[model samples]
Target: MIDDAENKEALTSFLQKLVNDSYEAELRRYSSLLATSSRLLTCDSIILVALSSIASLIVDGRVSISREAFIACVCVAALIGASILFSIICQWRIGYKDLASPGEQVKFVEKSWEKLSSDWNIAKSYSKTLDIMYKSVSSRNNKISVLLRISVALLGAALAILLILSLCMINRACAGA
Candidate 1:
């Protein structure tokens, strides 16, 4: 009976640690995704600025941008804007939802530790907590991952369009000369 009790205790400890570590890892991954999204937005902004500058030069007659090139630029600009918007929405959707305040979490953990000495009730409670945390984080991660990928693809398409537009503008300038 004593050996069985010891084994159960060890198992509970291991399980708790495993779940907590996994939760932390998920949080880290989420943070990294946010960083990536931020970088994407920054790049999008730079592209917009360049497009605006070119449009201004065309308006001022300093550059002869073809109608096709202008249309392509507009399309690419729209895509970039859409990508940024979708990315922000995705980040907002996966934003952190606090299950418990820090103080409450600490108190609850302390109580669970106290219960550990008396019975397996604390282990059971921890199991439930871990389940909830794991599922929530995993769901958010999956959703954000899909959205991020789409956003990236949109950005890539925009860049390609911008490249084509630049080529068209160059050809127009050469022909005009």
Candidate 2:
């Protein structure tokens, strides 16, 4: 059992001193990135469903459109499908490294306690943990961010194609009239 004095010392040592202010800010940024990924997933899913529904309606004779426009719609739907895939991949699980399990950390400290010289250095121990976590989290973050960019780019291209196709259809309609 830990004495009251030792417990107090341990609590004080761990009080917000385990992580830097930078890391705290970085955690918020990471959370924002995850939220953005979710929004992308939602938007891509909606666009893909809408495009697919239109294509199906045209195929089933429930909707009538020019052959060129139908083909353009199908092609744009494919683009959105690809974007949806990327967004889903971005939403997949990414393992961010946290501190060691409590049991493991306690055991490590206990084993090293016998060799102690002056006192326990929580900062040094936490720094090493941060080093490992940074490497893992940063790499995962980079991959996720790249996937997000790809999804956004694909979605943009699909929208642009749809816009151009609409303009062409309008111009053709006016000329025919």
Taken over the whole model, the C-alpha lDDT of each candidate is 0.79, 0.76
Question: Model 2 compared with the native: what TM-score?
Answer: 0.78
lDDT of 1 by residue, 23-102 (tens): 88888888888888888888888988988888899889997755777788789989988888878876684544447778
Give lDDT tens digits, candidate 2, residues 80-154: 888878877877777788888999988988887755332345555666677777667777778888988998898
After superposing candidate 2 on the true structure, give the runs of residues whose Cα lies further than 4 Å from its correct spot: 1-18, 114-120
Which window of 10 residues has the lowest lDDT sum in candidate 1?
89-98
TM per candidate comes to 0.79, 0.78
Candidate 2, which ten residues in sequence have the lowest lDDT sum? 114-123
Alpha-carbon runs more than 4 Å astray in model 1:
1-3, 93-97, 100-119, 168-177
The most accurate candidate by TM-score is 1
User: How many clashes (backbone N, Cα, C below 3 Å) per candidate?
Assistant: 0, 0
Per-candidate alpha-carbon RMSD to the true structure:
3.7, 5.7
> Per-residue error at 68 for model 1, in Å?
0.9
